[model samples]
Target: MAIPSKTIKVFEELLESPQNRLVEQAVESGRIPIGYSCSFVPEALLMADKLFPLRLHAPGLAGTELADNYLSCFVCSYTRGLLEFAMDGRYDLLKGWVFVPSCAHMQRLYDNLEYLQKPDFNHILDVPRKVNNDTLLWMTEELQMLADKLAHHFGADMSDVSLRKAMEQWNDFASVVQSIGDLRKKPNPPINGAEFHQIVMASLASPKDLILPYILDFKKEIEQREGIKNSRARLMLVGGHLHDPEFIRVIESQGCVVVADRFCTGTIPGFKTIDINNDSPYKILAEYTFAKTLCPRMMEDFDRRLNTIIDTVKEYNADGVVLEIIKFCDLWGVDAMPLVSALRDNGIPVLRLEREYCLGGEGQLRTRVQAFIESMGK
Candidate 1:
């Protein structure tokens, strides 16, 4: 289906810069832009009154000359690119930052950011390496403390009423995104991987209220449009921190339909609804944050993570899983070893690729994907 030009333009404008048109509008309306990375950060807390969470990304960074002085050459480009962006004043719109020490590279990025920008609010909410009753309680307490700090620093409304309202607002947004995501499950989907990637990336980078209407309109348009025809194999992309939709285009150009994704910025668990029940918003948020599909850093959750992928393959009817990791990402690099072996043990086809933050090597990636699809046919 040809996407409506208006909807495409909205998505494109949002991604064109860290401070997009909607972000400028939101800031002008007196909303504070709080920055965050990692899916582990509970977005609802950042969504409190007068504040919005801006997921930090550098989509088309040309070079990391600035970040290279602070970080080693071996750090993944994702982290380096973000640091470079901050150093270049590209993230000046953000008033604060919440970071999680998900990996050493990220920790270093946080360190550089703190030393360099030292924004109005600089905090890190340490995540538990293992999940348990004690850890859950610890997480709840941490979130409560975070709420208190945000209130103290930014005068944000961290009251239970405000937090609950924020979660509801987030839930509403997630439902709309999930509805659009479910389209890919059809035999022939109205949206392709690149188009869906653009939508998801734009939604994450902009304020929910500002982008929700455009998303709703786009959803309606695509619902009545014809499904894309003539695809080769169905594939699932699993990886970390891929903000470039052009990479998805390269894969799809090889004739495979990327029907599902389990990546950091992509949908799956990130877009899932926050099931609220009869509990304090903090506890609920803690549980929801802890229970997301595990990143490779969670050493004890390997079995569950592996099962999730295997189950996801069947759930999505994917012909194979494409496990792409950023070069020098220690956690995913190490995790990919066992993941490849285990998925193959479970009789699932897997293609593992190493890529950088910025999109490159299209000819090589296309060649590999084409070969993989051909092998799937045989």
Candidate 2:
């Protein structure tokens, strides 16, 4: 189905604009905005503290010389692009920064960002390697400690009432996003992969207050439309942080319908919500974030992660699995080949594509993707 033009317009406004209008307005109104990138940063905590949690994105960031000087040329492009965005003065409004360790590159970016004196109030939350009762206890205490620090730094109220309210709101947003994802599970899916990617990426770039209404409206439009049953092959895409929708667009353009994904930017982990009823909200956040996450960094849970991908492939009736690894991402680079072997052994066709973080190299990606689609078609 074709998503509503209005929905596409909304996405264009968020993606094409240099800054998020809602975030920019929030900062201009004397509210402090805290910047975060990784999923490990509990956005509910930031909102509960009365801080605007701006999800950091490096929109339109090309190659960078300034960022390259600090980090090696071998670093992941996403981190380097973000560093360039900050150095280029696009992120001056962010009062504080939160760093969650997905890899070594992010840690180095945090360290160098501190040295540069950008976003002076810095925090690092050490989430454990695996999920457990002990992990939740450890993380909740750590969250409480960070809450104290934020309260002191920003002079904002971090009350239980505020936390409950934020949890309710974030949970509502998650419900809406999950509904959108569930649409893809349908035989003739109402929405295509590229449009869905745009919506999710736009949500990351903008606040839920502004983003939710548009998505809800988009959902209604999607429900009223016809399903796309003409695509040649159904595919499941798996990868690390994928913000740009062009990769999905490329796959879709090659007559493959990407009906399932395990992407950081999409619904593998980010779309699920913490159940907020009669629970310590921080503990709920801790459990949901780590327990449901499918990151390659969570080495101990590879079986669980692999099972999730396999289940998605079966559930969606996918013809193939695309292991989309970023070029310099050490974690996924090691992960892709093994996952390819595993999926192929289970009677699933597999394609491993090395990708740049930004929208570059689509021509090369498209040629390879087209060949994969033809292989699946046969």
Candidate 3:
């Protein structure tokens, strides 16, 4: 049977609105919502007590006119689009905001937010450039301090019990997402990439309690569905800040199956379950956050990141990799130089595309993807 239209519609409707219906409902139910920009922010910590994490994205953003007043044209469109939304009062419902300096662009975004919006409960959880014992200790301390601030400001329950509970809850959600992601590894997977991307975006945007039931139902339906048999080539997407499911749809429209992805909003690491051990919850979060195969902002983790991409490609049986980065993103632009050479050296086909944060230039994107599939001789 084909995938249920109702299941997909639930996620599609959630994505269309600026403030998600579940998020608005959570606010109405006396839960506080906090806005976060990057994956580096430990969301479970934000969820400690009455706080809920709202991963920010500006879907269907048409222009950056207001954002342009403050940020230069040199800024990446993702940041610009977010600023545009903020200027439009799209995120006014959020009581607090947290940020991590994942890159200079993000740092600039924070700077602009501090000056322009002057949010009441804004804090930056400083993450280190390198993963070492010293940095790990620093990270653990930073999280504890952040928890303390949250408790002091919002009367949040950041006690070990609360933190642990939040972590456990997040892990449960991750387990379900992992099961869905594993389905993609099948020789002919039941779910396609665009559908999978929409599911993930909806999960991240909605509170776990509000969205999990719907996801569980969708997962059950997907598991029993027929496998897609018309895919010409399997691809693993690698990049930064790709929250738009339409981008995946465009790629798949060119006759390839996006089997796996390693991006900011992707599953490989983003939805990986945290291994619950006997360590302090903060320490566990610190270690877990630092250990993931993450973006190139981790200066000393290049080899680890490269290996994760290679391993994922093999694990997913992908014939090629499509690495896309938004225009004017310095971190990924610089990282791409070495990554392209390295992946090709390892006998992996790589197609590098640079586009704006908003989805456009579909004809060109289709052309490039078609060429990439042809190059793979699929």
Give all TM-scores, in the order shown: 0.97, 0.95, 0.98
- Using TM-score as the measure, what is the rank order of every candidate, best first? 3, 1, 2
Which candidate number has the best lDDT? 3
RMSD of 3: 1.1
* Candidate 3 residue 16 C-alpha distance from true site, Å: 1.1
Candidate 3, residues 343-363: lDDT per residue as tens digits?
999999999999999899999
- Lowest lDDT 10-mer window, candidate 3? 1-10
Strongest candidate by TM-score: 3
lDDT (Cα, tens digit) per residue for candidate 1, span 1-378: 344445766787789888899999999999999888899888887898999998898978999999999999999999999999999989888989899889999999888887987777888888888888999999999899988999998889898899889999999998998888888888888888888888899988999889999999989888887887778888999988889888998999887788888888988877877878889999999999877647987768989888878888888788899999999999999999999999999988899999999999999999999999888882
Clashing residue pairs in candidate 3 (N, C-alpha, C atoms within 3 angstroms): none
Q: Give the CA lDDT, 0 to 100, for residue 81 in model 1.
A: 95
* Model 2, total clashes: 0
Better of 1 and 2 by lDDT: 1
What are the per-model C-alpha RMSD values against the true structure?
1.3, 1.7, 1.1
Q: Pick the winner on TM-score between candidates 1 and 2.
A: 1
For model 2, state the Cα shift of residue 257 in Å. 1.7
